[model samples]
Target chain A: MTGAIKSQSGRLTEAEAIERAKQGDGEAFEVLYNLHKRRVYSLCLRMTANTAQAEDLTQEAFLQLFRKIGTFRGESAFSTWLHRMAVNVVLMHLRKKGLPVVPLEDTMETDEDTTKKEPGAQDASLAGAVDRLELQRAVEALPPGYRSIFVLHDVEGFEHNEIAEMVGCSIGNSKSQLHKARLKLRDALKKHRAEKAKR
Target chain B: MNCAEFQKALPEFAEPQRDTALQAHLRSCSDCSLLVSDLDSIVAAAPSLAASEDPNPQIWLQLEAALKNEGLIRQPAAPLLVPPPQEGRGWRLSWALPVAAAVALTIGLLVYRPSTHQNLQSTGKTAVTEPAAAVQTAAATNAGINEDQDLLEVVGTQSPTMRAEYAANLKDVNAYIRDAEDAAKANPDDEQAQESVMNAYEQRSMLYEMAMDRSLP
Candidate 1:
């Protein structure tokens, strides 16, 4: 059994586990799930902002990986492939719930107006002063379209082109949505600070 | 470049660049400079937010059951956590009898319904045991429904949040099963529809298994 073998060796390396899992080794599948579940769950949690949904999506994502592990050809890093699959699962769930996954191009033009810095407004420097918890709350407040782009780009560190391919948007659209997402976050954070001041 | 242009280009901007026009604007305008600083802070802080969180432990149990049901697990893996020698053995024995009995009953039903099995075989189709398979499916679905009821009873003992989550998930799976059943009835000859019905039953079974695992004392 793969579990017995792991007990003797301490643990199997990821490559060995992937090879074993491809052969339908249940222990190898568990090893792979343990290796990736945290990051996968975090991605889902950030994307959905709801623990129940995140938990369900995390299960679905791993279920998908298990079903398709036979077809993985190592064309990309395993983590990259898994992350892409996880993103797709979350997006599909969101679409089922009637949330827009991608902002339309016309809406993008209108969104830019909202993102523009006000004319001659005084600027508050958030550099070196932002609270992590506050930022998290602000992130969760973003609209679904902006949240998806923001989490994919800034939080998960996928580049624009890679994100474009995963979400089926142009590279330009990915960057634009990311910038708009940041602007929304900025406004959210500012509002949080203002509310704090009032209290 | 004006403030709008500077902010517009900011998303693509790399730091420490020698763009004199953008640099001059940043040097002159506090708002754009602070905007850049704020956006930079956000990017710098983003990775910290990516810290991984542990999911509920029952997820793996559910996943393992689904894998086994799908025939993706050829070998039964070792238990996830080894309990102390004194524990869980009685619980296992207690449940094992009923489950074994259920399996025996299912097998007995299949053996006694030889006419249905023979009729399917006479049809000369590749799925020669379709009727027998249907009988087994019906038995399994009944078992799944009973397990779901048992799960709901114990689910009330869980935290309200968990109970709500389980109820919502169970409702969704039941709805999926109904849809798949309708599809299978409408297109009885469609292999995909038959597979969908089976998949739906397996999903519900997995959920019940997961809830049962969580309910253990």
Candidate 2:
């Protein structure tokens, strides 16, 4: 009966929840939290690779979200806005800890490994050689730069331009880094599979 | 196309929609074909990877308590996820339950019984409104505290962090209780002070119940 909108399930839609949350509705904020905590927390954990720090960042991101929710003008999808905020939270924390953010400059020269051909990767029609668990482990073990681009591109499904905008890198840098990320993940997965075969 | 050219263009081949030339190269060139297949599988598999954990409720509790401490929201009747006091830091809290109960009971008896109510209605004063009334009410409040001690003990053993959280949340609630006590002392018959003191008691009870609700594994 109130002016607030509700979705089909009788719960407030994300937009309504956001509106209520902006008005200082705690339950509405919790509704938003419950809906996206998994994705946000997962993004934080993947980016930081430290559970405690990730948890801290997750909370910090949401608190910052609450503070900045007023500024959101519905220009982008809420998820994109939230994910970008989460990414920024992790980046800021990393900066505060004096961890160097790998400058995402466009590189003209290719890396030696990217230039090297993977013989097995060339002709084979892929079956199940790439294990999900193995690949996941490889990703978690990636350096922060590669891990983020990979997660943002392949995992979170952001386009190169979106990735560039979020991380303050060029679209070209995003594409380059994503290529390198995939290559490193391939190497990591191959090594993992080989180690398991040995065991 | 030679494998060199095919390999160089592999990044382009990774896009979801490959142009005819790239697809043609992937079809004819074994090495390029295999590379594309492997890369395709990799891209397909990436989105499934996720962190295996979520931020637990304690974080929410802390954030909310912080917001409340900063005077952001109107004070919630009882704080959420208040961690109990840290062990050996018991002196920081004012055990408002006993004192609050005493005040509530003294006020109740003064206004409730027919004879007392009639006398107070007629004269606007009662025998039980004297300072001695609080001393007598203290005995009943001590019994209530002893019972609450059991509840606190049960709530205490659950999580050190939760108890710590309870302590943090109660710190604010106690501040409210302290302010109400100041008002009550300044004006012994102040209705607002008496109501606030009782509200603090009710809020404390709700906080204890919140602990019980949370103690479930």
Indicate which candidate wins on TM-score. 1
* Candidates, DockQ: 0.23, 0.16
Candidate lDDT values, in order? 0.69, 0.61
| lDDT (Cα, tens digit) per residue for candidate 1, span A69-120 | 9898888888888988999999899889988676556544565576655433
Docking class of 2: incorrect
The local lDDT score (0 to 100) that residue A192 gets in candidate 1 is 66
Best by DockQ: 1
Tens-digit per-residue lDDT, A112-141, candidate 2: 555464654422244555655457567778
Off by over 4 Å in 1: A1-9, A106-122, B14-18, B80-217
TM-score of each: 0.63, 0.60
Candidate 2 lDDT, tens digit per residue, B92-179? 2234433543454454444323454345647956564644546644554565456455445444554332333345345444454455
Worst ten-residue run, lDDT, model 2 chain A?
A1-10
- Give the range of the ten consecutive residues with the poorest summed lDDT in model 1 chain B: B77-86
